[model samples]
Target chain A: MSHTLVEINNLSRFYGTLQAVKDVSFTIRQGEVLGFLGPNGAGKTTTMQIISGNLAPSGGSVTIANHDLLEDPRAAKNQIGYLPESPPLYRELTVNEYLDYCAALNNVPRAKRLSARENTKERCGLHDAGKRLIGNLSKGFQQRVGIAQAIIHLPPVVILDEPTVGLDPIQIREIRALIRELGRDHGVILSTHILPEVQTTCDRVQIINKGELVLNESIEGLEHHMKSASLTVAFHQSPDLQFLENLPGVKSVHPEKDGRLRVFHETEQNPTDAILRMAVNKNWGLYEIRPGRLSLEQIFVELTSDAALENAEALATTTTTDSGL
Target chain B: MILTIGIREFKSLFLSPLAWSILAVVQVILGFLFLARLEVFQLYQPQLMAMDGAPGLTEIVLPDLLGNAAVILLLVVPLMTMRLVSEERRNRTLALLFSAPLSMTEIVLGKYLGIILFLLVLLLMIALMPLSLLAGASLDLGLMASGFFGLALLLAGFAAVGLFMSTLTQYTTVAAISTFGALLLFWILDWSGQGTAGGNWLAYLSLFNHYKPFLEGIFNSADAAYHVLLIITFLVLSIRRLDADRLGG
Candidate 1:
């Protein structure tokens, strides 16, 4: 029995008439690295903001570690850290000075600020670049500095919104590794539209569409959802629809005009068992039974396409939000 | 805690080129004003010294010295205060300050005190003028001391207003422009006869009018109370603006 670290209940946000987060509710268990997935404007950032106590929810409530957000915000906020889409770096100061300032701001006592600074520097890969000014650092290093500021106070929940929006491949991999490392100790909520990010880094995935939680499950469940298991069998001779449909555990069999049959299997029922049964009964030549895999890109496209997302601003508008980013 | 914030703000004000520039320019102008004022004193001191033991040094030079400082403060105090919270917010450093352990009151007070400290340093630099005047002329000590007090109170009120404006936005340009406009209006709009013609009561409400008593080296309790009240009003407004982001209550 794990204690819930963050519990959001019926949280909804509206920008006047537009509903950003439509009744979003979820509980994040302690030490869980939950990935928040959605196309732009699917309420990922809004939900993240609510969890971090940065944005006020239009309805419902958030309780962090049993401290109600509306009642005991200070205590709740003290436990969570938030890094916005932009790293929020001070260009004039060196990485060390900025982090030290953040440390003092986050209430690291005078006696402990040095040790906290040392710890964050090591954890965030800033040990070698502390003296370098943030303006002079590369994008990746600047991002690392952002992470350092967010986690310098040893917060239990670190909310990162689009942490890898503008990074190269190698930088993305390094940041992923860093996120995984942080997840070992801190409960991290990472928001990104990049699907592979979830498959690789998240222990659990929640996909929201049109401000509604369309899918809320573990990473394996996501893999299963995207994994098209049942095969399509094209036969040389025709088989009766009833005979194939009567097959045990065959959820549905759609007969193609070309004498082929597409089968749907209940996730619990193995297609292999029913396929063997079909072969013995039909005595028809089985031309091919190929496996199908839905790439993360395909699933993302399918999940966020015009018919799917109902709001396809990810293409034209996320760019608008990135000016400051 | 307020003192700590004040010291940090004081350091930041001095470290910035703007503060240094304002200090130098104001001091030079005061220095020149003091020289001309000494000429007038030289013309009149003979008669005064001849009559019943001349009034000591603080008298003759204090008005011109204080008058020049008043003009200088009206020009520079707005610039000194415009960037306080506005720049922090513009550079995104305000978030760091917001999340820090210190409350908004401390930040505002610290930054306000820092501006006051900067003004004091410039005053000290200007004090050199009167010290030189003392070598050759006579002026009243009480009058000079009162003039400095009046100037401090006047600038303190202006700094408070500027600090309030800084909290209004994340754009330094907007903050600076609006603060300048607001102070300028306060300093000159009384000529419109709004405060004086059928609005004598409203005229009394203006910060400059309240501060005029201090400039004359008169420590009126009503004037002191007016400045203190205005300062508290702006500080409270700043604190409320900061509380907008806190979770719930």
Candidate 2:
């Protein structure tokens, strides 16, 4: 069994009267990259802050490597690293000087501080920018410096908040690859609203809506959710709707706007073979038949839209109760 | 870890134009004050020598200059210390320290010490202007030493108060303004007491009241204790403010 590196149980946070995070719970293990997904103000950053021991939750506890964040924060924090939404770059210092300070701040021993700084700089691809002041460097290099500081102490868990917020496409891809590389050894939790980032780099994804965990599943499970055993097929001629509906194992059939038929089969059946046989025997031209999979954007829209509907209903009921009261 | 933070803070101070500008303005004003006090002392030297038990050059020049230095520091120390934690919060870099394995005490002490070191450097330069008079006259070194010691204590206390104010707000201007206001209040606390009956406690709490003994070449233990207590109080308040931030978030 994989070792649990960070465990959060029923965590909640409130900014005065506003409930920012409510009863959120999740566990992250060694070698697992957990993608924390949420809309704006969905408590992703707050949860990450709690896990990093930067913020105290109103109600629940966080344990890092069996040490409680509140009871033994030093030991717990020593095992976790966090990069907040902003990179936190000290503009006046050179990259080398900033990283060295971070190394010492994270309790890297005097004997090992130099080597650790060098190694982290190399890992974050900050080799050439070491001599340049952070203020003089571009945003991309500043971000790399941010990552270098987070991992200089070699913690077991690293939490990054929006590590790729304002980067070019190539820079975003590089940072994503770097995150994936870090996940190979450390339990990495990154908060991002970018859906494709999760599809590419995350092993598991947790989507939170209104401070509640709405979806938590592996990437494979996400793929399966999108791949509903449906097929989009097109023919040279439009076939009878009744004949298509009467096909074996055909659960539903609908004609799409682009002159193709969307056929959803029963859970246990693949109707491609039966449809292919009938098309050959009847001499009906069949051009294409491909497995259907929803884009991550579509799935995200669907999930959040459902959540929005529930939220609207909840608001309506609360308003009605308020009026009755 | 505290040394690391202190070094970073001290180094950043030199890199900013604000620190340089503060240093230049302060040294120029204090230098001008030093010259004015020296010319006045020289003009009265013969008369002062004929008087019974007249004060020497150190007694006449050093105390007045250091007193002016202290008053000037009342306005300038806030500028030096206003960015200690406020700028870190503004830039969101305080999270780096919070998320690290550091206690709030380390952060507060490190930053406080960093600014104190810079203020000490300023104090050293101002000390040189007074010591430059050694080439022309015989100076009482003991009296000068006491005056310098008092200025050190005053600057440390001022730094602590400024640091606490910085922790209260993310806007550096607010921190600087409120710190100036706080120091100004303490400076005149004794003056306000002079008008009221049975307000000795207010005078006792006055920062200048504690500092005045040192300026007069008298090392009173009670005066020293007051400055120590003031520094400790502000530093403790700063540490608690940072703790509340972690908890409140």
Candidate 3:
């Protein structure tokens, strides 16, 4: 297994009475890309800032490469590179000059600073724009410069907050490719609200809603969750709802318009084979039987929407009533 | 780390047209004043030669020229120092430094030293006007050096105040104006206490009062200490402000 590069334990931050992050904890291992997914104002940026040592956590701790962020900030910060929401560029400086400054600031040795800068620029596709002033470059090129600065020191962990925002589609694709490339060697934490960006780029995904981790799963596990757990079938002649619900391996049955029935089942007990056999034996002319899958977008909405919270509360009250009986 | 940041800061100043324009304007204005003082010295050279206690070219030209330079710098230093921290905050680039493996003290001191380096170059240019008198007549190097030293100390104090003010706001204009206001208040502080009973402390508190002695070739430790103290105090405050930002209020 790859070694853990960043360990954030119970990290919390409060802005006066408003708690921005509440006991958030996660770890990133080397060569893993962790997608930090959240809705707007979900405290993603605040958490990124705390992890990068730009802001102190109101409670809890963060360790970067075994160095406690609060106790040994210099050592911890040295092990990570952060690109904030807005790329921090000095508009007047040339790309080469800015990269050189970043290298120096990151303590790349004097002899190796030039190589570090050149290699970063080349990797970020800024080779030809070395002489151009950053202010004059296109937004895409400027963003590359921002990324170049972050990885110039070759830190073990790289944190990028909204790196592809405000870019054209082509630029976005290029940056995503670069981020995936970085993930090969570095433990990368990418925070974004874009769902596909997470699906296409990350090995693991974490969803934060209302300053709390709503879901944490590996990509394969998320795919498994998205797999069809329910089946939708239609009949020329409608079958009894009670019989459909009582079928082996079936969990519940709900009737829909056009004489269709939706049957849900357990994860391991798929009811498709049983339902097909029963429809033929019972003479219920089944025309359409399709498996239902949940898209990531729906999952994200279900996890983050206010309706989800209310649904959870309603479920809790019913469970209490059942237990009381 | 401080040198790396300082060098970058100094180089960045030249990348903007503001620094070049300020340099050009200051040189033109101070150069013209230097010539005017030399002309005045020539006009009174014969009358002074006959006097018992005659002040020579160094005594007459250096103090007036350097004093005018100080006043001009009083206005210009704020402009130079205004963007030191405030622009970084406004542009959201301070995060670059904050996330780097550097302490607030290193960042603050590096910026301070960067502006001081630029001011030292301006001071060298101003000193050349007095040193040119060495072509024909004997010059009092001690008095010239002391006058320039006083001006350097005064500019250092002004820069510290400007940096502190810059840390107080994200707006560059606000930083510049507040620095001007604070420096102006310190400049004329002694005036309010003049001729009043128990006003000696106020006079001592005034930046100009301490600077006045150095212009007269009086190397008083108290004046030097005063300027150093002012520099340290404001720098410490600036550092504290940055720490507050990191910890969040």
Candidate 4:
């Protein structure tokens, strides 16, 4: 449980004067599926590029299975299988030829290259499209080939950048299932802006906004910690807002449609018992009391919006300094 | 790793119609030029035989035909080499190379050798035209070998330049035109530098000036070295360009 496969320390990347990634640090353990969520242009691709040895970082270091990326790129890269955002493929070659080339490029031994190619093709569901030209394949199959090539050598660490973009809903579901399967054997880092993707496929989630890591937690932790502790109750007659707000352990109360009120409380405290006692004493005619679960979309919106507001405030202060205000 | 990339590149080249079209076009043009040179040589055969210091078939006909072939190669090599890197970049397939464990040198050299192999096939086809005269006439094998050797080096240099230009942009057409433009600069600089003091060095930089010795049946080591140096310089520049892309972006 404690074996770390990838350790990224204080990674930074600057494009001219604009900082793309700033001092980002994280570690991924073996057999852990880490969902890297970020808004557009939030340095997700840049960070993935640096870890895969495609781009150089402006600062910091990355180690893969104890191999330093900058000092020994070949050994470090050999441990990583990367699928970039666009699915880098040679359109002229057939699926089999392309995978064979990829296996060779990743330095699979000559004797095992054929078996490795066949196994990867089977894993990515490309067994039927072996002889088909890559350009002629549908977008979904092409994306599969992209994944097939990445895992041709059976690398220990697999990095996929926006693997499900432009995929049909069904295809997205299938790919998500495939990613989940991959997670069982290899440490996987998947980047996406889709909230449900992380919920369904990832064991842990890390969200980046404005080039900064704003949220990092297990899926269970995100559901339990960031979720507001609340109960939705319906009454035969509406309760006074001040009466419910002043209830023991009740921090705030929001009235909903159909004579219902949502009562909030601290994470460690449940106000339902106190609300029930108060309702009976006042003859509030309460009919139902049910705990509410925060939807993943709500959590995503709240976290990203909060990060955006902080970024805006930081930008304003920098602009003020530049203007000599 | 280099052979793997080279084999893939070579196979992919034949997989497209553009490579076949180029091969057909080169063959037709070279055949017509060879026939024209042969006719001219036959017409002048009697007068040349009667005159002192008259040039033979190898000296008179082969050089003219080969010079024309060299000019045609200037056009054909760029078209062949333009897509080597530029198309990969345009199609966004270069990212595959970046993430792989292979070094930049391996990729560059592998692609270069792949194009060189294609050009070798083209050279073999052209050489058969000159070698066919062996049955009827006594030909200078030495002169023909030197000419073929020079053309091979010259084409290798052209491919190097094309490969380098391809790395500068994602547009294949732009790569093709720039490679043609760069070769033209090297070709014309020799002619333009005629009889000038400071311009003498410019002639040395020209591809034709180094090739002139081989065309004249003189195997000058200095001239051979020139072509080798030119090929090495452009290939090194290509490797450096790829490295910058990996490091900077």
Candidate 5:
């Protein structure tokens, strides 16, 4: 097993009275791409900032490569390369100049700074635009320069907040591929609200809502959750929904407005074949049938909304108890 | 790391038209003022030849030229230092420095040094106007050195104030205006205190009061100390302000 590159324990942050990040914790081992999934204002950026030492956490600690962030910031920060949500670019600087400056800032040895810049530029597909000023480059190229600066020093852990945001489909795909390639050797933390991005680029996914982590699962486990346990069938002729509900492996049946039946079944016992056999024998004139699976978007919405509801209930109870007191 | 940031900041300034325009405008204004002083000195030369222990061309022209340079720099330094930290904050590029393996002290000092280096170039150009008298007229090199020394200290002091002000806001124009307001107050502080019982300390506190002795060719350690102290205090405040940002932000 690879060694852990980052360990965050019970981290919390506050903006005045508003707590931006709650008691959240996670770790990233080398060669792991951990997706930090959250809706807007769910504290993903705040957590990333605290880890990168851009912001101080109100509680708990972060350790990077065995160095405590608060106690040994230089050593701890040396292990991280962070690309903030906006890329933190200097538009007046050319790509090579900016990357060289970043390498120097990261304390890359003077003798090796050039090769580091060259290698990082090559890796980020910035070879052709080395001499171009960042202000003059396209948004995609500017983002590439941002990523190039982050990784120029070859830090052990890279934290990217919304790296693919505001990019075209092809640019997003290229960035995702680059991130996956980075994951092979470095522990990467990719923060975004884009659900499928996590599915494609991350080995593990974490969903945070209302400053709290609601779900932490591996990609394999998420894929299992994504498997369809329900099927939808539209019929040209109406059938008794009760008969379909009584079929083997069928848990329940609900009729749609368009005269379709949605069949919910147990995970291990798919009722598709049974329903098909019944439909054919009864001559129900089934016109369309499709496997129904809960999308990642739906899962994200459900998790976030559920967390919000729970927080509201908890807040209400606290207020009521205060009144009772 | 400080040098790395310092060099990048310095280079980036030249990459923008603002620095170039500031340099050119200051040079033209100072040059015009220098020639005007030379013309006035030429007009007074014959009359002064008959007087005993009369002030020479250096005494007649250099101090006034240097004094005007100080005032000109008072206006120009803010324009230069306004964007030092504020622009980084505005563009969100400060995050790059914040996340780097650097202390706030290093970041502040790096930027401080970059602008100071640029100001040094401006100072050199200003000094050349006085030195040009060396071709024909004998000059008081000592007085000229002290005058330039004092101007350099004043510029450093102005830059420190400007940099600290830059840290307080993300808008460069606001930073520039606030810095100008602060420096202007320092420039005329002694004016309000003149002839009053409380004016002695206020006069002593005035940046102009300390700088005046240098233009007069007197190098008092106390005057030097004031500028040094101002530079150090404002720089420390800047560092603290950035540290506070990391904590409170």
Candidate 6:
């Protein structure tokens, strides 16, 4: 349990004068599936890039298996297998040829290349597609090939940047399954804006907003952390606020202008069974009820939009400061 | 591992339909030029190979052959280099190469060696021309070999330039055209001064100037050193550019 697979301390990256990632630190333990959650251009990719050694950090250090990344990137890097946003692929080569090349570049040893390629192919479900050219494959098969190449060397840590991007629903499920299986044995850090992806697949979730880590917790604890829980309820004539507020679970009832009421409760309360019983007792003609779970999308917008609003205000204040002088 | 990368790049070239078309085009051009050079010799043989002012085969035929080969290599090298880094950038495949365990030096050297190995195969197809000369007449194989060696050096330097330029953009057409233009400028810089004026310094800077001594069968170390220096300079610059991308931050 104490095995720190990845230790990041105050890491940051700056592109010229602009800061891309800033003051982010986290430790991932062995066998943990860490879901890196962020919206577009929120430094999730930049952080992942730095951790994977494709981009260097402007500040701090990342240690993989106790090896410092800055001091010994080769040794640190050898412990990592990264699948970036667009799977880096050789379009002209067959899958077997590409994986064999990946194995060699990854230092898998000459004699073991075949076995390594087979292992990655089997794990990534690319065994049948091994002989096909990557460019000729459909987007789904191409994604599988990308994952196959990343894990060819069997590194302890696998970093995937939006592994499910541009895939159909079936492809998304297949890739998520692949990710889950990979996380079982390898410490996997994946970034995606797909919130349900985080809920269903990840063991831990780290949400970065506007270059700063806004939320870092396990999926199990995420629901508990929110101050409010949304519960959907249906009643005859759309039950009034006093009825919901009086319930033991509910904190407030913010009635929507659309005649439907959105009842918010304390995070710890389930409110489903209780709200149902209350509705029946009152004979308000209850129609529906559900406990609120923040879809990954809503959470991302809430976090980033909030941050952006704050940033806008800060910009205004600075502008005023300059103009007043 | 370096050889492995080289082999992968070499194989990638073969996978394309255009590579075959380019090969056929180059062969046709070379074959046509060979016939033209032979015809010119036949027409001017009386004055050129006179008993009183006889032009040795080495002096006339070998220089002419090497000059034509120099032009062919220039056109061919750009085609090979077009995808080296630019395509990787375009397809976002550079991330894979960068994240791999190999160093920048290994990747760069591997690609150069791959292109060189491919050029050698093309050289083999033309091997018969010199070999036929050896069987039919008394010829200096060493002198002819020097010409091949010079061709290889020029290719090495130009390939490095092409590879470095490839990293500047993601468009293969831009990379190819830029490399061709850069090499054309080098070729012109070498001869423009001797024909006109005000370009002697440019000629000294031209890559072709470094190559000419070897073509003349001089076996000069300075020429070899110049080629080596240019290759190293460009390669180092490319590596440093990637270094900035990955770590200079």
DockQ winner:
4
Candidate 6 segments exceeding 4 Å error: A226-299, A308-325, B39-53, B191-200, B247-249
* Candidate 1 chain A, run of 10 with poorest lDDT: A307-316
DockQ, Cα level, model 1: 0.33
Cα RMSD, model 3: 3.7
How many clashes show up in model 6?
1
Q: Which prediction has more favorable DockQ, 3 or 5?
A: 3
Kindly list the per-residue Cα lDDT of model 2 for residues B1-249, writing each as its tens digit: 788888778889999899899999999999999899889988998999899999888888888899899999999999989999999999999989999988899999999889988998999999999788789777888888998999999999999999999999999999999999999999998986886777688887899888988988899988898889999999999999999997895
Better of 4 and 6 by TM-score: 4
DockQ of each: 0.33, 0.78, 0.78, 0.81, 0.72, 0.57
* TM-score between candidate 1 and the true structure: 0.85
Looking at candidate 1, what is the lDDT of residue A118?
89
lDDT of 3 by residue, A274-307 (tens): 8889899988999999987888898898888976
Better of 3 and 4 by lDDT: 3
Per-residue lDDT, model 3, residue A309, is 79
Instruction: Determine which window of 10 residues in candidate 6 chain B has minimal summed lDDT.
Output: B125-134
Task: Give lDDT for model 2.
Answer: 0.90
Clashing pairs in 2: none
**Arrange candidates by TM-score, highest first: which order?**
3, 4, 2, 5, 6, 1
* Candidate 2 CAPRI classification by DockQ: medium
Of the pair 4 and 6, which is ahead by lDDT? Answer: 4
- Which is the better candidate, 1 or 2, if ranked by DockQ? 2
Residue-level lDDT of model 2, residues A1-325, one tens digit each, is: 2799988899999999999999988899999999998889888998988888778899998999999999999999899888999988899989988888888888889899889988998888888888999999988988989998899999999999999989999999999999999999999999998999999999999988889998999999998888876899888878876777788889889999999999988757889888888777776789999988888777777766786788899999999999999
Q: What is the per-residue lDDT of model 1 for residues B75-193, given as tens digits with 9 covering 90 to 100?
A: 78778888888877667555555443455677677777877888778777876777666675555667777777777777777788888888888776777778777776776645555
- Candidate 1 local Cα displacement, residue B139, angstroms: 6.5
Q: Tens digit of lDDT per residue, candidate 6, span A216-308?
A: 888767766543478766566666677778888778887667556778877677677777787788778877666656765666678778867
